[model samples]
Target: MRLRKPKKEWRHRKQRRVRITAMIRKELDWIVHDKISMFILFFLPIFLIISVGNVEFNIDSRAQDTVVYVIDLDSSEYSLDYIETIRGENFTFTVYDNHENPDLVTMENAEALIPTTELGAYLIIPSNFSETLLENQTAKIDLYIDGINTIEMLVIKYQFISANLLYQVEYQVFNSEVLYIPEYRPEIDRSILENAVPNMIPTILYAVSNMVACQAIVADDPLKRMLLSPTRKGEVIQAKTFAYIFFGALLSLVCMCVLTFGFGIYFISPLDTFLIFWMTTIFGVTFGLFFSSLASSRLQGAQLFLFSFIFQQMLVNNLRIEPIVNYMPIEVIRQNITDIVYRGIPFLSLGNQIALIAGMNLVALGAAWLSLSLKKEVA
Candidate 1:
């Protein structure tokens, strides 16, 4: 019997023939078939830009402004002193004379002209107000706060009352003593401000890394092929993971550019800013790849993505498993990645940023290697 021609046996090899280009084409095709999904993907960055633009964050602890209408039934020095005690830019005051029409502050006017339409709330100082104020008796001050500005109005009112009481005695001795307030020190709070981006970076990186860091086998089928030529499992994993990291890094760079030139993320050196953003990107994408490897299907991968995304959202409110989620690498896995927009970057100073990124990549690559199946399901 004639011997049958031996079937082709494959050996692993690397052909630097732009292997990634083939994959990119496949990804593009996937995008094409689903126009709606592709359209959404194209606009993802802009949507997030507008979405994040509306968000606000604060760190300083201080009182806010409030408006008060003082019905001065007592014009005595004591009553005046009581009013003077509450004297501060934090509160806006309008002293209504007893002879003046109460209509301006009447139930009718209060309903029509109070805080809802004005600066916030109004307080009434009844007749003999100064005599009782000096007597150390509980003198009543009726207040009407616009319910529309309820939270803001309440905060202002509480501060106004508390401050007025504290300084009431002080005014008795020093009529015009100006209290000194220390200026805010950015240098002292550099660490806190610098590390704030970690809260957002983890989640942001996760979404972008998926564009490149998907682990899968490439097979050659005439109708559908992910292979340009013979591609090894190890090579495929390496290329994909590296590309994923690159995508995150690119996204971070893009955001950094917009924040600096477009939205003004910071007021510092371009080099320094770039370094900080780069470090943040590394932490995010590396964590994303790690999560990707653990998943069994695209659905599982998306589930992982949602978990990271939610975790990032929680970080803005300081609600998460870790108190330091704001600065974690995993946070980049969400679209919520931050880049020292309001503060500085910590754990990723110049050299440390580089080291951390390199370290993370190493960890991700190692994980991918361990999980890659030479005898994969597709081949």
Candidate 2:
């Protein structure tokens, strides 16, 4: 009787394994056939890497003509010489005399001009600038910059500082006296693409995984019929989750390789970075599955995914409430990516982040399982 019971149990276990494998294969087939899914999973990352990496944001001779507005309050020879010395082929300077346009330096005028005109930056040479400098004292030049584009702002600021340094050197040579100018130069060693691509990895993985997985159960019309044939909802959900996660890992690998080999963006710990990306994919898939289970139709699932994505992005990027933002899932992922990729922090050092992500994944997976289990029919 014991031997017969063991044989029956073994047969049941084999049958379950076959069922799971079949379900996983079915899910993979669906992804391969779906045009949108294929693009998001395989092609989107490559496209983004190529398009974003090729952009040039360096402050060099290749800089496009930048229009700078100057309100020269000190119309002295020294100020004029300073202006001329700072001029570059890439800069088109428009000098406004204080007597001609006294209101140009006003806060209201600056606010209006910077936004409305093609003004890259507005400079004000103080009336006492020449007097102070002649007296062997440091003079301050008030610079109001249009900070809409960060790269452009940095470039403009760099050009101004470089020119000012040259002017100071000329002054020292002409007077044969030591004149001190307090310098403020920010260290910008990496290009824009180098800094941006690392931050983008987690976001891209999360977004694509979430987007594709949101339609997993809701869009599969055969799921309802399958459930009637000894296939439990939990098994179905598990199969779909496994399949999506497998593909998500592959997508993450492809993205990292493209950015590293194709674009020369290096990761300090490639293995650790890839692990974090894979974890992000797991979180994204489970989160989407929870929503997909809640949704009644494919359209509703898509809407939920879009709304969730936008809301998360706004919170992570724009929200200033630090206490709340710190615990948010996307924000945590972003911070960890920065730590691992940019700061070279080890993956195990981010214990809190990894734990939170794991906890969130479990909660999402549990919620999805419950939702699917309770549903009368999954359509």
The lDDT of model 2 is 0.79
State the lDDT of candidate 2 residue by residue for 1-379, as single tens digits: 4554345442486778888889999999989999999898778877877767776533353335555666787889888877777664434345444445676654456657787546667778889988988876778999987788777777778778877777878655235455575554555466566877656767788888998899998999988888877677888888999999999889889988988898887788988888888888898899999989999999999998999999888888887477878877777877778778866788888888789878889899999999988988788
Regions of candidate 2 where Cα sits further than 4 Å from its true position: 1-11, 57-188, 320-323
List lDDT for all candidates, in order. 0.50, 0.79
List per-candidate RMSD values in Å: 7.6, 7.4
* Number of the top-ranking candidate, with lDDT as the measure: 2
lDDT of candidate 1? 0.50
Candidate 1 per-residue C-alpha lDDT over 356-377 given as tens digits, one digit per residue, 9 for 90 to 100: 4477677866775565442243
